[model samples]
Target: MEIKYIEKVKKAFEMVHTKKPLVHHITNYVTVNDCANITLAIGASPIMADDIREVEAITSISSALVLNIGTLNERTVQAMLAAGEKANKLEIPVVFDPVGAGASELRNRTTEQILEKVQLSVLRGNMSEIRFIAGLEASTKGVDASDADINSGLAAGCSISETIAKKYGCVAAITGETDIVSDGQHTLLLENGTKLLSGITGTGCMCTSLIGSFCGATEDFLVAAAGGILCMGIAGEAAAEKVGKEGSGSLHKAIIDSVSNMNAEIFTKRAKIHEA
Candidate 1:
């Protein structure tokens, strides 16, 4: 599984370098700039639009679509459904990020509605968010969860994520210090990210965008997810090493720089993993 993940990562990188697919995102305002920049750094084009007028049009031409509910609103939710339906009609892959799923009843209902509208290739979010989407009661504090046990959160999340993936018929990804990806029977644990990433405001949103970019270009959803996580995680580690506790601002800059310098060879060499 280690070799398989490595190969998949390499394959995804190559596809991004070659296809350079356009990823359409109906994402949040908090991470719009970062998400677009990161997508470009990874050799994928980014289009951020939520306006009902252009959302479906943009998604129709895009290679992959991403839906993020960080700042949910009536208009954006409608636009997300419209874009997702358009993308689905074209058979373009779609990725969903339920940023603050357990925060409110409205959020949970909205996520479920979106899932019913489109077939998600990958669902990316933190433990609480993923757990909420999986029909589990999770403690959520607005946009974040403090109940996360850093030591074993990944294991517990992975166990639950597998069940969620099977139930939803899509790849479930719960990201943390050690990210977990599962497709029911198969599971992969990624130990490639850095602690400093938690300091960043839009890291999770950016990861969702990154995964969308990969999904746009790669036919293999799992490979695309691994590519996004491994690449982003490695970049986070590089950024942290360069910043060294100064602050999240510096770390964010380093993350962009690291991503700009990242290539297929770097991921093939540095990614650590436990997989099926």
Candidate 2:
């Protein structure tokens, strides 16, 4: 990867912390608090608005909109569409998280509807969720990604991401032990993060929030997605080092702290990225 792209990531990180952009989230209630906290930790304000009445109002002034389908419901589903449409109208960035997409018919249908309705700038999800959204066969257990591992050697992940991005005309970000980010024309593979992330409940949700934060501060959706993923991975590794043997609880808290204290220097030093 070129150093200039990495420089862009660094600039985006600092810009988010400096600007503290307002991020409107129509996210699931399950990991709502974690999403808010992570947004704040990365120096962005988060507003969780599910009510249809205020969604448009909130998105009107927000810099980015995050729509997560972790805990879907009828009311929130409409609210997400309302907010996402408003965000698009206002030319604000929209980051989508198709959580548990392939696990149930409801989730799958909801995801499809959101994709059709919203003009997303970034789509972040696990391998199975992305595969399902891309109209491919995938195995998912409940809301979590399947136990089947993603072999890093295969080009399937990169090709799939590129295809999805081209098909949808948005940045496709697939997260695993290795993260693949593609904007159809450009594809990147990021090697960062720790296994402790698997033990956390809201890490993926929080990552979506982080992506929103970065996208809110930068116009480059590809760079924004990569920065968010790298930030989470680096913070997870730092948190593990701080409290790896302690417990999941400690590690979770430490991850937030690491994000709070993270700087551009640390990000540039720890980021292991390459163009696919």
Candidate 3:
């Protein structure tokens, strides 16, 4: 990553606190509360309304929209389509999270349906989910990344992230032990997070929410994506240090605290981003 890109990330981080943009989410119920709380922690407002009747209205008023298929259902999927299309028309950035893309027929079909219909500004998911979306062979352990896929490491992640970005014309973010964010032209590898992040549920969903929060503040999708993931990674590291032997329960709360207290100086100094 260049100094300019780091500056951009810093600026986006500041903008989120200053603009306090509203992020509308048509997301999975499983991590919905954490998503909303994380958005707030990052200095953005979150409104989670999946009702098809009101999704358009909610999205129209939001600065950004997040669509997550974590806990998929027929009705919410329609709402996601409605909100996504509305966000496109309004030019509000939309971030899509293909939570369990390769796990089941419903998830796979829903992922395809959203990609076909929505013009996503950013597509974020685990390695396996992203690989599946990129038309590569992927093994998903439910909504989690398969151990084999996780072991594929950075080279494979960079390749798949780039492939998905080019294929979808959106910033692609593949999060794991090492995070890859690509916008076809520019690819960044972020190596900031801890393994403890993976031990907790909703961390991935919260990462998406953080990205959505940043997207609400800026049109630079690549910066927004990087900033969000970097924030989560840094927060995870901070939480891990603070928690010690207190366990994951304490780490979860500490993660939120770390995010809420994140500043530009901390982010710029601690971010582990590199050009790929």
Query: Which candidate achieves the best lDDT against the true structure?
Result: 3
lDDT of 1: 0.85
lDDT of 2 by residue, 1-276 (tens): 657678889999999988899999988888999999999999999988889999999999999999999998888889999898899899999999999998988898889888999999999999889888878778887777776635423488888899999988899999998899999999988889999899999999999999999999999999999999998999999999989999999999999999999898997788888887
- Flag regions of model 3 displaced more than 4 Å: none
lDDT of 3 by residue, 75-150 (tens): 9989998899899899999999999899999998998999999999999999889888888889999999999888
For each candidate in turn, the TM-score is 0.96, 0.97, 0.98
What lDDT does the true structure give each of the candidates? 0.85, 0.91, 0.92
Per residue, candidate 1 scores C-alpha lDDT tens digits across 1-276 of: 688778777888888879999999888898899999999988899988899999988988899999999988899999999998898899999999998888887788889899887888899888878777766667776777546533445567778889888988888888887788988878998888877788789888888878988898888888788778888899998888888588988889889889889987787678997784
Cα error, candidate 1, residue 245 (Å): 3.4
Report lDDT (Cα) of residue 59, candidate 1: 88
List the candidates ranked by TM-score, beginning with the highest: 3, 2, 1
Model 2, poorest ten-residue lDDT window?
Answer: 145-154
117, model 3: CA deviation in Å?
Answer: 0.5
